[model samples]
Target: MIPHDRPVMAEADIAAAAGMELHTWRRRHGSDFRARVPVVNPGERLRLYDQAQAAAFLEGRPIPPAPPAGEPHPDDLLSTDEVAAALGTDASTVRAYASTGYLPHGTELHGRRYWPRHVVQARIDAGDQRHHPERTGAGRQPGDPRNTAPRGRRTEARVQEVAAELARAEGEALPALTADELAQRYAVSRRTGERLLAAAREYLQQTGRGA
Candidate 1:
């Protein structure tokens, strides 16, 4: 049976549960492991961990014990005031930073801003990820987890070339093939296919129709 209900576990079991190689786990958290966890059997080299505490440490969060009955617990979403406190600044300053794209991912609702505590904290730890003009979009920044593009692949030029080819072949009318068919036809990944189609649509919208 799995040791799912047992919160405190042996080192190897903890590593397996966390889906990490033992060596990697040891290397990453060696100091903390030694300091925080108890040695179940020093003679037999058995180390133990509280799964919740270990998981929090592995994820780079604070390792404090659970809050007392009356104390408030921290939430994942930090309000503008909470974020300001974390940054050693004021709420208004945080709003300005968010407006200028200097802060990490945030959402605005009912005129109040909420930042992902971990994301913003990570950025602060790495020294504020400064705003880059090329990264801003309607709702997200380039460093967002969902905003990744494949590395070392430049497809805009080729997409434009394909658009021109289709333009000449069809005479001012873009091809009707859907994104999936275009992916299969051009041997590009679905994401690249979508980009190509988007470029084609923009081209057609601005000028005449294309691929």
Candidate 2:
């Protein structure tokens, strides 16, 4: 059995714990895995299974009943895939939003990006999702301001501020911020963030603080 340090297991973890080949397990169980196990993150790219329940199933015992379903804790850290699931979209779209500043910057952990549950919830509340039907309402005129492409409110000061912030994250030994992360932090367009990131890196190099 795999070590029980985590409360959940990815598909590979489940197979490892069960002493089965990963491909074999996937081939035999992937389709019905969710149906038979207590899935912790349904409809998400990084689906997790309740470790105890999965172990029980693997051991040929009746799985224990899952707890009542409830909302994720506000402080809960969610992966990009989890956020996409909450937003009723796909991971690529979520990444695109992050890159475009539609979504805010998230924390980086174990080489993956994550956001607090509250952040994802706030986005849902905003009703500004790119895929929302309301975003494509019937047009009455060609000269409508709504037809104008969105632009970033840019300034020299903001660029400097973003550069400083990037330096701070680096000083703290955090993962280097990506353009998407910068856009999320400043609520600017991806192109703007890319420019800011470049300037930040230049600043860091000049200051001998580049990571």
Show the lowest summed lDDT stretch of 10 residues, model 1. Answer: 66-75
Give the lowest summed-lDDT range of ten residues in model 2: 140-149
lDDT tens digits, residue span 1-211, model 2? 1112336777767777767766778777767776788566665434567777888877888889876655547767788767777887655456556655677877763235678787888889987645333334533124322223253423444455556657645433335668897665444589978988788677678877665
How many clashes show up per model?
0, 1
In model 2, the runs with Cα more than 4 Å from the true position are: 1-6, 27-35, 77-93, 97-114, 121-211
* Candidate models: Cα lDDT each: 0.52, 0.63
Clash list (residue pairs), candidate 2: 105-184
Residues 29-86, model 1: lDDT tens digits: 5667768754422432124455676677666687757322332223355666667677
Task: Tell me, by TM-score, which candidate is best.
Answer: 2
Q: Cα-based RMSD of the predictions, in order?
A: 19.7, 11.5
